[model samples]
Target chain A: MPAIQVTNLHKNFQTKRKAVGLRGSLRSLVRAEYGTVEAVRGLSFAMDPGELLGFIGPNGAGKSTTIKILTGILFPSSGQATVLGFVPWKQRRQLAYQIGTVFGQRPQLWYHLPAIDTFSLFGKIFELDDRETSKRIAFLAEAFDIADLLETPVRKLSLGQRMRCEVAASLLHKPRLLLLDEPSIGLDVVAKQRIRDAIREMASLEGVGVLLTSHDAGDLEALCKRVIIINHGQIVYQDKVSALKRTFLTSKLVEVRYARQVAPDFHIAGTETLKVAKERYGVKLRFEARQTPVEAVMARLSEVGSVVDITISDPPLEEVIAAIYEQAERSEAAIAK
Target chain B: MNEYHPTRTPAWILLIMRELKFLLAVWKTNIASAMEYRAAFIAQMLGMILNNAVYFIFWVIFFDRFRDVRGWELSDMFLVFGVAASAFGLAAFLFGNAFYLSEIIARGRLDYYLSLPRPILLHTVASRSISSGLGDFTYGILSYLASGYCTWDGFGRFLCGVVLACMAFTSFMIIVHSLTFWLGNAAGFAGLALNAMVTFALYPVTLFEGFSKLILFTIVPAALMGALPAEFVRAFSWGALGKLFLGALLLLGLAVLVFHRGLRRYESGSAIQVEV
Candidate 1:
């Protein structure tokens, strides 16, 4: 059975429309207006056990709303969602015991207390016995290289150190499923690498199903094999990371450095030559793949001049995601028309 | 085959023990953190003591001008003030987060408690500990001792009063906290209402005759939290005690019902993470 099953889940919020100033406030007191916002609309997805899925979206793309519903933090207005064979919102207690959550922006550790104290608190919260709690804490602390910083207060620790502690705190119970929301936010390159490694190790070694959501493409690239894209309260696409790259990215930029400068009008059918720059002894050409493959582009470049160095790279994930959103917008408009 | 039955342990006892364990763990951390800022801790404690003393002085002067009002002596009024202040302080110290429910809800901090494997009220109250409430506790103990109200029977009555007072306070706090589910940011409104109750409650309810007394006793129930408990101390009446107990039970039931009902309409705030 799938570890998580969500079917047409929906959530809407009614917010009061209050005006400014004393007059408006008094006016509101007499008769206040309310506006309804549809946060999640008929969202449906399912994940198998031990699957590592990346839930990616823009700021208000309903990624967090979906996660909240899945984790039993918020109830859906309509439809059904079950995690581990139990209804999430109805069986929150049971779900909480089996799942762990790490919110990167919010360290679960009590700010005033040392990281170890927070770990111990979670231990008690989950009712883990002393022996098992200590063993797990020790193991995670060492793996995250936060053993030395265990005694340091959370407030005193740096963002990277606090993040490590937060991850350790979340795993003290050895939850069967882990939900990490922006676990690499506000961390340096080294810290991000460490977090990615830890997440990879946890999923592979412990067999814990992982759902990660982040704006950081590096985090998605490093830790997730499967990517799910959400836009405007809907999942537009979900597939293997490699497949997403290959399907969305049609053109790969191939920069070639020549031995001598040449004013070559590099005319290739089904391809646009974007730019040309002359170096002291070399020429560089930037092109977009209209119909030709990257290999063909490289071959054409080779024919044009002596290629000293060559590199081919696709557009950044940010651009690809933006293009996807634009494509979605255009399609919606077409359907409306 | 013999029928199997489950043993029935009192729910309050179980709740108390769970809360005690949770509080002890939280308190240890808070105290350690408090020690780090020794000067700030002392300053805050001193400020609270001074605040309470100012109020005590006002009562003293009022009683000096008019030795008795509504046939209640100045000393008796002092006793009421002492008990009410201490009880309020203790509740504030232990469950102060109840006062910040609106902010927590607005910021989505309540998501943590909602997601936890425990009652939302218990989790929210236990999330933090307030050290300033110690001042109220101190004054209460001192006033009970110095005012000659600490007789053997008075002690027993005071014990009962303390328990009932805590229950009443908890009910009030829960009711206020639950309002956040409906009135998104009702902290200021709730505070105003609670302050009004406390103000009237710390006085002798008998002073107000007829409908006013009924209003205090029933609608607001401030009189029961204060004057009624004080009356029990003066003399035990089964009828009066039963009335107070019944009132508490009813209010508690109502509060819990309202909270759960409002929870149905609770729209959690943005998923933006919050730090405690």
Candidate 2:
């Protein structure tokens, strides 16, 4: 059986409609209005065991809603979902033993308590044997490099340190399936890289099936083998992460710092000046990687002024997903017309 | 990777034991959190005790003038207030989350408990501890002594009354909070209902008559939290104790049923909340 199987899943929410100002508020108190909001409409997908799937979507695109359903946190309005052969909502307790979840916005650890306190509590919660719990804690502490942090109160640790411990706590049971929602959110570049590395290592070591949702494109590129792009509660794209990047990673964003200020009109062909700071002697440029060679673009940029430093990288994942959303919107509009 | 092993034990006793174990774990965490702010915790507890003492003073003054209101003397009033406060305090101290269920449900804070592998209502109710309730618990013992119930049997009976009162108060709060599933943002209404229940519990049942008395014994069950338990403690009667036990069980059943039914329609909140 697949690790996760969701078919024709739908979730509808009835939200109160509020009017503006005091009159409307008083009016609503006497006679309130409610509207149905379809959060996830017919979301269907299946994940094989040991698969690293990147679930990507813009905010309010039903990413978290789908995760909640899969984790048995919220019941679907209609249709069916099974995780590890157990129906999520109906057999939630049975399914919980095999799965681990880390929600970035929600801290599972007790704020005032040490991470070790929570680990011990979770040990009782999962009903692990004393020896087994101790062994797993020791192993995870080393694996996540949180040996020192285990003693620190969760409120006292830095975001990165706490996140590392959070991931470790979820893995104490050696779960077969792992679900992480925006695990690298608010982390610096170095912290994000460390987290990505730790997650990839853990997944490979335990052969755990991972379904990760992240807005950071680097997280997808570094870890996921397959990517699912969702918008408006529908799947717009699903394919190999490498393939998605290859098709859409057509542009490169380049930043150049000059020793002296360059002319306002000092521009290069096949390139767009995204930002120019005359005082700082810095210019940000964007160009199609396929259309303009990096060597040609560099040659032209050097002509403007003596280059102090230069950096080049692909455009962020949000831009790529935005383009995909735009393409999907256009197609949807065409179908509507 | 380990195969998925189901933890669904068929034995009802074992299930209750496991749930209890989880409850203890959550309570430990809550108490530990409260202790982290030692000065504030002490202050809250002391403040609550003083507040309850002030209310008892008014009862003492009233009894001094009128002697007794429909056979309820100063001693009975002390026991009534003691049982009500202690029962409420015990429930609040251990299952503090019960008092805030409506707010939690309205704010979609159930996400955390639902995601875990435990009984959702039990976990939610025991997630936090009310520090101020320590005062109520202390006052309960002191009031029982002050009411001149100094015998071993009286002490034993007071303990029973406190247990019944706690169960009744906790279950009643659960029923009121469960309304959020059907009526969104029912926090304001739940608070008012809770206040009414507390107010009725603090007074003598003799003060109420006819439909008001019926409502108290049935829907609101303020007597279950205060008068009936106090009456049973003061004068032992199997009939009154049986009624209180049966009533508590019914309220518990109603709470569990209402909460589970409401869980079906729970739409999680969109607002970003971080406890840390």
- Pairing residues by index, what is the TM-score of model 1? 0.91
What is the Cα root-mean-square deviation between model 2 and the actual structure? 4.5
TM per candidate: 0.91, 0.92
Per-residue lDDT of model 1, residues A41-86, tens digit only: 8888888899998988887888888888887888888999889898
Model 2: per-residue Cα lDDT over A231-337, one tens digit each: 87888999998798899988999999999988776688999988888887999999998999999999988877799999999888778988998898899899999
Q: Provide DockQ values for all models, in the order shown.
A: 0.47, 0.52
Deviating ranges (above 4 Å) for candidate 2: A252-313, B1-10, B274-276
**What is the Cα-based lDDT of residue A128 in candidate 1?**
77
Please tell me which predicted candidate would have the highest TM-score against the true structure.
2
**Model 2, residue B120: what's the lDDT?**
89
Count residue pairs with overlapping backbones in model 2.
Answer: 0
After TM-score superposition, the amount by which residue B172's alpha carbon in candidate 2 deviates from its true location, in angstroms, is 0.5
